[model samples]
Target: MNPAAQEPLDPRDRPARLTVGVVGAGRVGPALAAALRLAGHRPVAVSGVSDASVRRAATLLPDVPVVTPAEVLARAELVLLTVPDDALAALVQGLAETGAVRPGQLLLHTSGRYGTKVLDPALRAGALPLALHPAMTFTGTSVDVQRLAGCSFGVTAPEELRLAAEALVIEMGGEAEWIAEESRPLYHAALALGANHLVTLVAQSMELLRAAGVEAPDRMLGPLLGAALDNALRSGDAALTGPVARGDAGTVAAHVEVLREHAPAAVAGYLAMARTTADRALAHGMLKPEMAEDLLDVLADGDSLGDTRGGAGGGAR
Candidate 1:
């Protein structure tokens, strides 16, 4: 035998190009399959239920056969179960029950909420299980594949299969951050709380700016928000600023009244968030105790806005 042929392959090395399949060609599935294709894997088949998913598959994975879920497992050496988080369990159980999962085949899911435990049925059927969740958001566009470069993947797998998981993430241009199986839920929740809520907060700020007569809210917010985000990432609680952080109770009270008049629906959220901010600032010694009392009272009482209504002008009516 030749010397190279006689050597055993390293477990952490990328596996030879495998035939890939996608069970749900939603925004994430086709994008990941496309990335894998870029890594020299062959996307042999994909299954998509909705018209949108079918179209997306055609866009991101042109020429790959669109087949049934069972057919996808039948033909692929590496199957990506990219269905909605809610439907993943049922789909896996169904696949396992139908004997569709094959021995030694690789089965991966893109769910952040779950680790490999959800793949136990497939595991019992001799399928290799991997939970590789990209921490970045996907737009169902070709850009998502490019975005995967330097992305962080929350990875969980069997001890024996750890290297294989890392290899796949590396192939997709992602750095693997191993998450303990038991910590998956908390890990996912933190992502949702930060990323999802940040979108809501930014949109709300833009709407409020528009109400304040800013002609181009996006332009005004771009640099401010960018710097704020960078500062928060670098300094954590020490980076906090604005009226709440300064313990400016009068300024906050004025804001509450303005919001109550202009955006009554947003008043409750504003109060809740300000209280939380106040708590953090005080705990970190950014807010003096004496300064906190009035701020807490302003945040605690909805009627506190009434005190600031006199200077609110005739437009308040």
Candidate 2:
């Protein structure tokens, strides 16, 4: 870290001086606070559910006070509620229940699944509600802490809160895009279906590889996955490939059969994704209309198709 970079001396560092408090000091809270501090802003207070989290905060944010969520709001002008998704609403409600939030304070959450709606109570209390979700994974590692610089942050808030949230996201060296407040749940659902479900899909692939006696699935798959991801990123819909993209009905039938026999649990996800994927392949002009129809017919025919290893298609979605 550059010494100059450590100082929030620039005029643009206004967001840093905006007294910030963090709740749920798990993976995201500490990382966010560290980013704020590195940007030369004050991370005034933090809170967590467990001793371990508090201890972690003590190490990473040594100068900041360890306080209850209420104390955090009491002292800080900007409060980031980085708790688990299920717990976020409860935390906001809990704070509102106690009337702990101060007027004119800014309340934000890191949940991709929710927008300002989670902080309805705070909004009702004359605080502004914002949602700033980093569109990347956080493994709670030091590397992830460093790598947040270039990630895109999905930001949503009422018009009054939007500029501050965008400024905060920009201060973290990330790009910020405004999402509709009402559309946030649907938007977040799409992200979950893409990112979270991709995790499951990759894990399932690893499981299949392990069952096949492949050694070190991570080592084996990482490079292949990386290249496929690169192609997908560059070409967008044009990157679609493999059996379904080629309109190979026989291969699609085989895949369904194999899943039914060996990975029955995965059949539903496989079929659903395949049908959607086939539609994309058709749209991308990768498959002829007849072939796409044939593939969709095979995929949609509920009873007959069995699971088999189908063609390897590179997908960008």
Clashes of 2: 11
Model 2: per-residue Cα lDDT at residue 227: 81
The collision pairs in model 1 are: none
Q: Indicate the residue-level lDDT of 68 in model 1.
A: 99
Q: Name the 10 consecutive residues with the lowest summed lDDT in model 1.
A: 308-317
lDDT of all the models against the reference? 0.87, 0.78
Q: TM-scores for all candidates?
A: 0.90, 0.83
lDDT string, candidate 2, 153-182, tens digits = 889877755667777887777889788877
By lDDT, who's the top model here? 1
The segments of candidate 1 whose C-alpha lies over 4 angstroms from its true place after superposition are 1-15, 303-317
RMSD of 2: 6.4
